[model samples]
Target: MKVAVLALQGAFIEHEQVLQRLGVETVEIRQLKDWQQPIDALILPGGESTVQMRLLKELGLYEPIREAILIGMPVLGTCAGMILLSEGRLGTMDIEVRRNAYGRQLGSFHTVDTVKGIGTDVPMTFIRAPYIERVLSDKVEVLSTVDGHIVAARQGNQLATAFHPELDDGTRLHELFLGMVVGRSDKE
Candidate 1:
């Protein structure tokens, strides 16, 4: 299946590489025009949320993305990407976001544990990750957690993670996203 990784900034290339390793066709999304292409799924890589948001607005993709999620286009977001998908943020910014809740990049570490729906203990990398303070709706399903805070969640066709799964050798999360894309395509 074809998957588009938002390439505006951040570790998008890493996500593309991982997806390519999984035998999936991948593309770097730069313009809103790119989203018109027939792709089974999309991935929003970790980055600065404020900058990403501005880029999305400049590219006129903010609404398109929201619309796609409403229409059931499977999307997987990581780190800053997760913050973008959240209905609310916890940082000091105008939007409620717990900025650097996981501490700074230097504080980044590895952990092995079973994510709720991803299965088994997966090695997750967190760099200034944001935790889910409150899920806006029942549509969002919790997938994983580090402590009591929600780390991963799926809202219908949308899936988001506070950690970077691409940094590890494991492909469980990628595989799950692929499954979601395939499942959605089959229904079409």
Candidate 2:
């Protein structure tokens, strides 16, 4: 199956590499035409949320992508991508995210945590990450936590993690998203 990776900024190439290793076809989405390509899922990689937000609008890609996500295009958001998907905000996930909740670069860290359904020994790399402060709706399901803070969650077609799964050696997160994509297609 094919997936779209938002390549306008951040560690997008890292995500693409992970997807490639998983034997998944990927398309880098930097323009409107890129979004028009057929794909089963989308990945919003770790990055500076504010700059990504501004670029999304300035490049005229904000609305279409937002609408696609709202309508259930399966999406996996890491770090700043999670912040972008929070409700009453740029994207459609029903949660409130505090940007850089873990502080700046020096505050960055790494740990291996159990990601609920994803199992233990999962390598998590947090770089200026943002955690979910609260789930704004009952539909939102918490997936993982680290240091008493919510780090991963899912709501409908959306999956978000405050850590950069792509930066680690684990493929569970990417496999999980690909599963979601396949499950969605099968149902259709």
Candidate 3:
């Protein structure tokens, strides 16, 4: 299965490297033509949320992506990606995310925590991260949190994290997203 990683902005390359390490083929989605490829899943990486949003729209990729996610295409969004998919943007997932909830670049940090369904001590790196402030839909499931702030969550086939798992060497979160992709493909 080929996965599409949004490459307009953020840490798309890091995510691609991690997925490649997992033996998964990934295609970089940088333009509207790239979005035309057959993708089993999508990964939205950490970066400037507003900038990413503008680029997505400028390149005519915003709607297609939102439609894809809304139609149950498995997606994993990290950091700024979380903001992109949260309320007011893609709005594909029923979540309210507070951007820069962890402050600026100076507030960046690393922490080891447990991610539900991915076991314990998962390495998490936060950089100007945005945490889920609240769940707008009952279908949303909280997966992990940091200092009472929602850091990870799942709703339907969408998985979002407030931290950059790709910045670390762990593979559980990527594996979890792959599992979601596989499960979705199986159901189809």
Which candidate has the top score in lDDT? 3
**Comparing 2 and 3 by lDDT, which wins?**
3
Model 1 poorest ten-residue lDDT run:
88-97
lDDT for each residue of candidate 3 in 103-174, tens digit (9 for 90 to 100): 899998999988999989999999998999989989999999889999999999999999999999888999
lDDT of each: 0.79, 0.90, 0.93
- TM, every model: 0.91, 0.97, 0.99
Give the clashing pairs for model 1: 89-96, 89-97, 90-96, 90-97, 90-98, 91-97, 91-98, 113-121
lDDT of 2: 0.90
User: What's the lDDT for residue 161 in model 3?
Assistant: 99
- The residue-by-residue lDDT of candidate 2 on 1-188, one tens digit each, is 88999999999999999999999999999988888878788998888888888888888889999988877899999998998898655749889988888889998999998987789899999998899998888999999999888999999889999999999888999999888899899999
Error of 3 at 150 (Å): 0.5
User: What TM-score does candidate 2 reach?
Assistant: 0.97
Superposed model 3: Cα runs more than 4 Å off:
none
Please tell me which predicted candidate would have the highest TM-score against the true structure: 3
On the 0 to 100 scale, the lDDT of residue 119 in model 2 is 91
RMSD of each: 3.3, 0.9, 0.6
Residue by residue across 84-135, what tens digits does model 1's lDDT show? 8765432111122365787888767788877766777888888888888776
